[model samples]
Target: MSNLATKKLSGLLLKQLGPHHLSSTSAFHTSISNATAENSKPMITGLFRTFILELRNHSTLSSDELMKPVQTSSHSAQGKSEDQKDQKAISSYWGIAPKKLTKEDGSAWRWNCFMPWDCYKADISIDVKKHHKPSNFMDKFAYWTVQTLKYPTYLFFQRRHVSHVLLLETVAAVPGMVGGMLLHCKSLRRFEHSGGWIKALLEEAENERMHLLTFIEVARPKLYERALIFAVQGMFFNAYFLTYIASPKLAHRIVGYLEEEAVNGYTEFLKDLENGTIENIPAPAIAIDYWCLSPDSTLRDVVTVVRADEAHHRDLNHYASDIQCQGLELKEAPAPLGYH
Candidate 1:
């Protein structure tokens, strides 16, 4: 990856993290209220200052803070921050499932899943329609994962009003995940069937609905009063993800791809449920200047849910394909790729 790409990925990973390790703030009304309540500058002004490249409608964070120095395994094992100490109990309030045994430390869903996530190489990087007769399903599965993470970095950053292109993509994509599922169902009958993969998909879809509400609820004022930019970018992402279903081979890959995502989502949900209530992380110093809520909530929770649902969708797709691909063994094109 280029330096910029590397930095963005780092920021994405770090956005959900805390000031230290165990810790990670609030809605716009809360910030404005706080700002009005105290004309005196915050004690930790630097904490609120923009870090890396600022997106429109928001202040930027420091590159160092944004990138968070990709940690070495040893560093991760030893370096625990002061904030991490306070976060242990607070994390439990979020209700994330499978809380750690320590019981007194922070409980982040991603934190708990770090090891397993590292091991889970959800690679979906193959050209399905063009490769094999009935095409070995394995290649399509791997491709789905890869296609999911790849990004058009520049388009992601392009400016439009207050949002950088990427944030808009996120805002739009959450609703898209649910819509795509509804449209992809085999028969209207399948939608009514509430069992196995269908049941899981519904749960995931509900979560996605919740996620969109959460994003808007957390950041309502700006979106309601100011221009909506990130929301648009999200639409771009939404459309891109949906395009995959057009190709059966590609759809097959996505079905598996989504399953892995669903697994990650549920895994995080388990972490969150165990923890209790997850307090919103503070917006970057820069973002607070304009936007109120942090993007991490939308990014982590929504995407995780979509991924988890996708995981189930993959299963349904596979089952559906079992019969479709029986006789006509056609080579398939690759699946549409992009990170949720």
Candidate 2:
């Protein structure tokens, strides 16, 4: 990391967290001063470990890189100063300082820090037909279980991808939350650390919740659909909770397949939008703000970003399953923190 980028990241840490949370002395902290026997806080660590690396890794970027300069009005000299003030306010809201590094292209310089990977695009159009099929009987069982529960939505909702996403997200968010909670309890009971898996799983749950929120604004589901969400969430929550307790590996594998199906569904949604089967309406404000989409972004753009997010989730859950296959716990490996 460059000296300027390091400084910017350190500043970001100072603003969002107390010194007891993350000291400015190092790129990462192993522990904090707020630790207590009754409520020992877990160490802050994860895939964010690579956040402050050299510029060779261009795919992942910091929050600073997402920032664009506010265009100054050409009518008056005061316009430039006004833009600067407004920029400061925006920066403040994000817990960023006023001192910013700008690139020649008029965008903020990419800093070495942890930020959401919303900008990462995946090659979703790849031919995954072979990969989609089961390789064995056990794989077949998992595949069939997912497909059985999944295909019925098409008959019920038709091409209502927006509402489908809302329902899917509600169920998808459950596993992470359940996993995190169980890990938290396990850590407390065994007096063993989770190696950051707790936080990582919790973050995944929160991310899925945000996806549901964004879709709710876009779809505005009917009352029956809303009722279905409640029924699905309640049943899926308990089912996933037990599944995780019985075999975390199988649970993760299930989610991995679920996310793969989600990616496929979103791709179909994108195709329908492009084919004029679905209206390319303006993106919901929440989606625009959360994904940092352009002002003129439409539903297609939102789906693209959401699909990217689902792809990342699919990778993560499959990786978790792989760890279990190796007779290791998720705590044995680092979890991708801001993986879209």
Error of 1 at 102 (Å): 42
Instruction: Quantify all predictions' global Cα lDDT against the true fold.
Output: 0.38, 0.71
For candidate 1, lDDT tens digit of each residue in 1-340? 3445433544564465434331212322243233422332441142234222133222345434644556888777666664576565545555875644321124332323122222222232322222222356655554644355433422443222122212422432343344345434643644443223333334334433433433453344344323434444455455545644454445444445444443443455445534544443433322221122234433334333334334434454454345345643221212222221
Against the true structure, whose lDDT is highest?
2
List TM-score per model, in order. Answer: 0.28, 0.62
What clash count goes with each model? 75, 0
Q: List, residue by residue over 296-340, the lDDT tens digit for candidate 2.
A: 999898888878777877778878887996899888898787665
RMSD to the hidden true structure, all candidates: 28.5, 21.9
